[model samples]
Target: MRTKQAVAAFAVLLALAATSCDDGDGQAASGNSQASAAGNGGQGALGSDGDGTDGDGTVAGGGEAQLASVAGADELIRLISNVTTCESPSTDPEDTTFTGVDDTSSETAVGQESATNAEWGIEERATCDGEDGSANGHQLIVVSDMARFEAAFKARQEEEIAAGEGDTRTRWFVGKNFAARIYATDSEERDMLSLGTLGLNCAPGYTAPPNSTTQDALVDGCVLTDFVDA
Candidate 1:
C-alpha cells in the first residue's frame, strides 16, 4: 500500500508540471501573434479606419474653399470704412514729412516744419479706373507721430520672419518729423502698400493728372503710397 501511494503522488506532480509548461508556451505564442499584427497594421501605411482621409480611398484631405477678390473700389471702401475713420474725400492733400531710406524712389524732401502740414485720415480720392472712367480710391493717409502703429507693424513683421516667412521685405525709415515703412508687392514695378508719411515724396513713378501739382496729386489722382498695381 505504501509503495502504491508514493507512485500516485509522483504521477500527480508530473501532470501538474506538464500543465504549467503548456500554459507558458501558449501565452508566449499568443503574445507574439498580437505584437506582429499590431506592427503590420497602420505602421505608416494608408489608414483604413474610416478617418476621412485619402488612405481609405474616398477623397483627399478636405480642401479649403476659395474666395473671390473684392469687386469694385466701393466694395473695398465699404470694407475699410468699418475699421478706419472715413470722412469726405480731402479736397487738398499734402505730402507728409517722411524720413527714411527709400527702397522705392530716390526723391527726398526736407521735413515740413509745420504741425498742420498733413492730416491723417481716409479720403475718397479719385484714381484711374484702368479703362476710361475714374474710380474713387479711399486713401488711408497716415501722418507723423504714429509711433504705436509702426511699432506694432514692425513687431508683427519680425514675428513672421522668425516663423519661417521668407517672401517679404520690411524696410523702415525714421525721420525727425515722422517714420514710414513699405511692404513690397508682387506688382511689376514692385509697387508698395505702405502706411506712414504719404505724399509726393513717396510717389516715384506715379504722376498726378497733367495739370495737377505734386501736392494736389493726392487729391486729384496720384499713386504716392498707392496700393494698386497696374
Candidate 2:
C-alpha cells in the first residue's frame, strides 16, 4: 500500500466524481460499491514501484499525457482501450473480447465543459454479459490532470482528517497520467504476488459474496492489480 494520506486523498477525488456520475439523471452505475472510493476501493496505501523520480514521481509513458482541455468524453473510450490491455487471454481464451467503453454522460454533462466534466474517464463495469469471466477482473476509472487530481485528493484528505473522520486504510497506485482505485471485499484477502519477475499486489483464492454482482465478485475474489505503467 502507498500511504494512508495519499490513499485518502485519491479516494476523496474518486468518490466525488463517481457520486456525481451515479446521480446524474441519464447515467446509471451497476450499483457496485467497490468502484466507489468510500466503498471497498477506498481502503489502503499505495505500494512502492521504485520507478519514480526523487522519492515518488508520476508514472510515465504511453505518449504524452493528454492535455486537460482535450481529455474529454471524446477521448475517454480510446484512452480506456489504450490503457486496459490486460485481459486474461491465457486463462480464459474464450473471453478475449474487450467490451466497448460506454458513455454514461447525461445531457447536462456530455462534454469537456459540462458541470460533470468528461475529463474523468468512464468505468469498466465488473459484470460480464457473456461467458468467460475472471474473478480477478476489476472495473477501472481513469482521470485527467494527474497533478491536480492528486492535489485535490490530498486537500480532501486534510479536510477529513481535520474533521476527525480520517480513513487509515486507503491505498493508491498512480502513474504519470493515470490513477486506479482498486476494490476488495476484505482487506486481509489482498496479497502481493508475482507474475514472471514483476511483483504486484492481488492474488488468487478469494471468495465472493453470494448473489454478488460482477464487480462485487471481482473485488471480492480477484487481485485488483494496477495495469497502467509509471
Candidate 3:
C-alpha cells in the first residue's frame, strides 16, 4: 500500500485509527471534507461491515461518543464508510509531502488504541477478525506516540529527498486549527466516507491549548490545533 508519490507527499505529515471510504465524486469519496460536527460526522476508513442500522433505528457512535459503547469495530468501520465528502475537494488527498513515514501493519487492525498510538501500552498486538470471520477490512494498527509521530514525519521527508521524491520547494504547515492525521497511500483519495473512520477531525481545525497538542490531533472540546509535517 506504500507508494512513492503518496509516501513522499506525507513525508512529515500524519492519525486516526483506520479510515476509508468517502463521497468521492468521481473525485473524493463524496467531495465532503468539511468534517462532521463532533460525533455527528465520521472520519477514518470504516469497513463495509455495518451501516449504522441495527435492524432498528439508532445511531452508533465511534471512539468518542455514545454509539461507541454499543458498537464494535465493525460498526465503526461502517460509520466512517458512509459519510459525505467536503464541499470542495482538496488539491490532492494523496499529498505525501507531509506524511512519509512508513510501518508495516502493527496489529490493532482499526479499532481505538490506548489513548496514544501505543494506547495498548504493551497489549502485544492482537489479531482481530470480524464476527463473520472475513478479515477483508478489519485490521487495527499500532499508532506512533506523539513524539514519535512528529519525528517520523520529519524523517520520512528526509528519506523521500534521499530518494528524490520531491524538491526542496516542499514545505510543511502545522495549522493551529483542527484536522485529522490521515493515513493513506499514493493512489488513495480520501473523502468523507473514509475520513470518517480515521477520526481526524474536530470542529474544523483549531489551535490546541498547550496541553491538548499530542501525537494525534485531539481537539479538546473546540479549541483546535493543526500540524503540517511537509
- The TM-score leader among the candidates is 2
Off by over 4 Å in 1: 42-230
- Show model 3 residue runs off by greater than 4 Å: 1-76, 83-144, 166-190, 193-230
Better of 1 and 3 by TM-score: 3
Candidate 1, residue 143: lDDT: 32
Cα lDDT of all candidates, in order? Answer: 0.33, 0.32, 0.29
What's the distance in Å from true for residue 210, model 3? 26
lDDT tens digits by residue: candidate 2, 1-230: 56998999999999999888768733434344345634522543332444321222322221112122223322422333332333322212122111112233333222422222232232221222112243544333344544444444454445555677644233433333343333333221122111101111222332222221111111222222222222
Model 1 root mean square deviation, Cα atoms? 23.1
The TM-scores of all predictions, comma-separated, are 0.20, 0.28, 0.24
RMSD to native, candidate 2: 25.7
In candidate 1, what are the lDDT values of residues 7-68, reduced to their tens digit? Answer: 99999999999999999999999998888756644123332445423442222233211111
Identify the candidate with maximal lDDT. Answer: 1
Global CA lDDT computed for model 2: 0.32
Instruction: Give per-residue CA lDDT, model 3, range 164-225, as digits (tens).
Output: 76333212212211122222321232332223222222222323333222223332322111
TM-score of 2: 0.28
